[model samples]
Target chain A: MAFKAGVITFPGSNCDRDMAVALEAVSGEKAIRIWHGDADLPDGLDFIALPGGFSYGDYLRSGAMAANSPIMRAVVAAADRGVPVLGVCNGFQVLTESGLLPGALMRNAGQTFVCRTVPLSVENASSLFTQSFAQGETVRVPVAHHDGNYFADEATLDTLEGEGRVAFRYAEPVNGSRRDIAGILSENGRVLGMMPHPERAIAPAAHPSLGGEDGKRLFESVIGSLVSA
Target chain B: MKVRILVRLKPGVLDPQGRAVHHSLEGMGFDGVDDVRIGRMIEMDVADDTTDEALNTMCEKLLANMVIEDFAIEKLDNEKAPA
Candidate 1:
């Protein structure tokens, strides 16, 4: 069976195309593009990707407006139904704002937009998104955002840590994120949110300086999981 | 009814923007600035019959992210005409 995936495109979403292309390149199936205004998602989707961008012009709050859009309601419903969801960059903000994930992405402690590839340590390689990587293995991925500092109460943070939900942590302080968390997974590990743009790092030809193939394992992991399931 | 909602980051959460503002104040020779924190205020007009529960729901749902911020709601009385 062909792997089915959907990538949501909110207004001002610049990385939606890249996400779609990356999905197609990995899964050998064209990804369905869904709009923010759509109230329903296509049937039988194996995965959903929320691409990075300044959705709704970052109004009110980063990803706050987009989280309440019609498609997000469907996305939330689909997530609850056990479909794997991947949120990158601004999409990570949306997942937090939508309450699918814990914590909030505050302005970077440096109070500036950071755009570059950074080293990330795979903290939980057992999760669906990081299954291809070995625990504690370092990979370089591109991150571009102003509000990627993750904040949650100490209790919640402790809970997340205890549950082994932290999927990735930065090797160096890149965005003032709590405990240098670069990515996290939901309780059931079906949803993953990260500030790094794995889609941007999937093709070596696109980012030769970054030696851009390390991120392909993430997409491959999701595809592999879906195929096996 | 006039409703004012104040949203603020919880204590212990890092406030980089607030820290920058504090540094600017210090650069301007302002002293005794123990600390600084930034927050947002939202004002809205609603029907007089709106219940407190409704206002709380709004804050919990969208106006405030319970994870890192707290919200306080204040109801302001309308001005009365002089007799």
Candidate 2:
């Protein structure tokens, strides 16, 4: 069976094409492009991808406006139905804003935009998203965002940690996120949200300035999980 | 009714922008600035019949992200506040 993935494109989404390309490269299937305005997603989607970008011009708050867009209602419903979803950067913000995930992405503690490849540890290898990586293995991926600092109350943070919902942790402090969290998975492990753009790092030659193909495994993991399921 | 919603980062949450501004103030020879925190104020015009429940729902749903921020809602009477 061919993998069916859909990539959502909000008005200010700049990385939709890259996400589509990455999906195609990994799954060998063309990604369906969905606009933010449409109220419904295509029937029977195996996976959904929300790419990083300054949706709605980062108005009100990063990803806040886009989270309330018409299409998000469908996205939220689809996620609840166990469709795997991946949110990157701004898309991660949307997941938090939409209540699909916990915690919020605040402005970087450095108070400046951070754009560089950083080392991340695979904290949980049990989830569909991180199964490709061995537990505690470190990988380098690029992160580019101003509001990528993850914040949650101490109790919630503790709960997430105890439940092993933390999917990735920064090997080094790239942003002042609580507990150095770089990525997280939903309770069911069907949804994954992270600030780093794995799609941008999938191709080894894609970013020679920041060399690595560590991101390819992320896409492959999702594809493999769907195929096996 | 004119409703004002003040959304602020919860206490104990790090406020980098606020800290940066505080540093700038200290650089300008200001003293006794114990700390600084930044928040947002959103004012809205709603019908007089708008119930407190509705306002609270709005805050919980959109005006504030409960994870990192807290919100306070204030309603001004028509006589003194702008519609």
Q: Best candidate, DockQ-wise?
A: 2
What would the TM-scores of all predictions be? Answer: 0.95, 0.95
| Model 2 bad stretches (over 4 Å) | A206-208
Tell me the tens digit of each residue's lDDT in model 1 across A34-96: 999999999999999999999989987899889999999999999999999999999999999
Distance from true location, Cα of A62 in model 2, Å: 1.3
Model 2's DockQ score:
0.80
Q: Give the TM-score of candidate 1.
A: 0.95
**Sequence-dependent TM-score of model 2:** 0.95
Q: Residues A62-149, candidate 2: write the lDDT tens digits.
A: 9988998999999999999999999999999999999999999999999989999999999999899988999999999999999999
lDDT of 2: 0.93
lDDT of 2 by residue, B1-83 (tens): 89989999999988999999999999999999999999999999999899999999989888888888899998887786864
Q: Give the interface RMSD values of the models in order.
A: 0.9, 0.9
Q: List the residue pairs that clash in candidate 1.
A: none
